[model samples]
Target: MTDRYVQATMDVLGAARDVFSGHDTWRPLEEAIDAQLPDDYKALIDAYGPVQVNGHLYLEHPANPFYPLRTWISETIEDFRDVDWGEEDSPQFGGKAGLIPIASTDRGEYAFLAPGNDGGQSRIFSCGRDEPDLYEHRMTFAEWLYRYLAGEEMFSPGHRDFYPGPVRLESLPTAAGDRSSKWYGQERST
Candidate 1:
């Protein structure tokens, strides 16, 4: 079932056949986070690398130093902590301790995983801008991805809608010195 879902997601996203990093690349991140990333996420990254879905959602990839999972998680947590959750209009960032940001939207909304809950399998929590705003989905990352790609409104329910279309797969831009770029004249003149 999970394999089917992963394949479906890849098919829908029009991802390339070769973008995966080896398991060795993922080991350090798992060790740092002290949790095994969802198989679905690993598979998705393996097929698509890091990508922006529909020009809105951003998923972290381990290979991209700029937006690696570890860095994004830590920075997001710190930023969330700095926000005042006391205000009625403020978003509840730290309401659920150990909630890790997995995906974020362009509108400052995020999808989190409550690893401390449900015996560590993780539950999906999303904070959106609307009444009955914060909600949890008792589904695995794979299932949630399937529903999301299917435009089922699984996260925000009636408040959000997604139209299924040609999903775009974009490579995360690396830093100037990170690699030799032919376009930037970083390649050695031979």
Candidate 2:
């Protein structure tokens, strides 16, 4: 169940084959947030670390020491506390069963992992720039991420197609701070 979409994404992106392959690294964050993140999401992050997709979308890394995930999630949740979600009953954040931020874009788009309304499965909830209503995607993190990478309009409303060139994953240096290169990346092979 966890490997399907993640594998599809890895195949498309040509990411490193060696994934982190363990949940021990996420236990602290899981305990802090009191929620379990999807296995595919964890696997993807473990493989790719923090990366900027095509120079816009920034996927946060839980293991980034520079910007601790706990602080980042706390700040993200706080930033949305006073927002007008445009829904009669808005979803809460940072609680035992609340939504958690996973990524964001320069254009003010936010992607969150939310507890499934139907069951305990986790799903993606997105908020577009200047868009008050949250768009729910009843899919796992890897499913949503794979769609986004493939140019599906999973988050935004407009019909912006896929990138002109190969999908470029610009690795953020913070995750691997000791590396000599300030920035490095891999492009999806043709």
Candidate 3:
């Protein structure tokens, strides 16, 4: 059901809050985490196994002028069984990229939409990671677009990465990048 994805994302948030709400200085269990099912998210669990939510791949602690804290939920490609997540011979990401992610942290909610110009291509946006007022203003972008496409299971940053696609190097722009100043990453090369 459409609501299922929301529930799964919520479950993860609950766990995060439990661990983070208490202190001003708190980090996740690890940079690279293999999502452990919270029982409630059992249905959300992928057939392959639990999803790869927050990871070092998304969050780079490097000391750069651009922001770094890029936390997000990464899902395997097969999660989208029928969807053409990524095509073969994609130059950038190379091969099939199955792990799609809904990126979020203290930065904001953004989705690595899908691979376009080869595996290295993607469309990122603030999903629900906007400020209180902003979140209210946006977030329905992906929802509306996916609906127009008539996609059965739309990809939410926090939902299961069911789409089988590629994770190209060029697409890894930090939230601070021109893509939108929604989060902190790197400045887009004009």
Q: Estimated TM-score per prediction?
A: 0.73, 0.82, 0.20
Candidate 1 residue pairs in clash (backbone atoms < 3 Å): none
The candidate maximizing lDDT is 2
Q: TM-score rank, highest first?
A: 2, 1, 3
For candidate 1, which ten residues in a row score worst on lDDT?
Answer: 181-190
> How far out, in Å, is residue 145 in model 1?
1.8
Best by TM-score: 2
* lDDT for each residue of candidate 3 in 38-111, tens digit (9 for 90 to 100): 22222222111111222211322211124322222323222223434255733121122322333333333333
Total clashing pairs for each candidate: 0, 0, 11
Where model 1 places Cα greater than 4 Å from the true spot, the runs are 1-3, 87-97, 116-122, 130-133, 177-190
lDDT of 1 by residue, 1-190 (tens): 3456666666566535344455456778767766656777777766665666656667777777655767887788777657555667654343233566778777777777766557645478877653335578877776677677666765576755455445544455545455421111011111
Compose the digit string of candidate 2's lDDT tens values, residues 80-165: 88787677778898766678888888888888888645585557988887687778888888989888877888776783437754
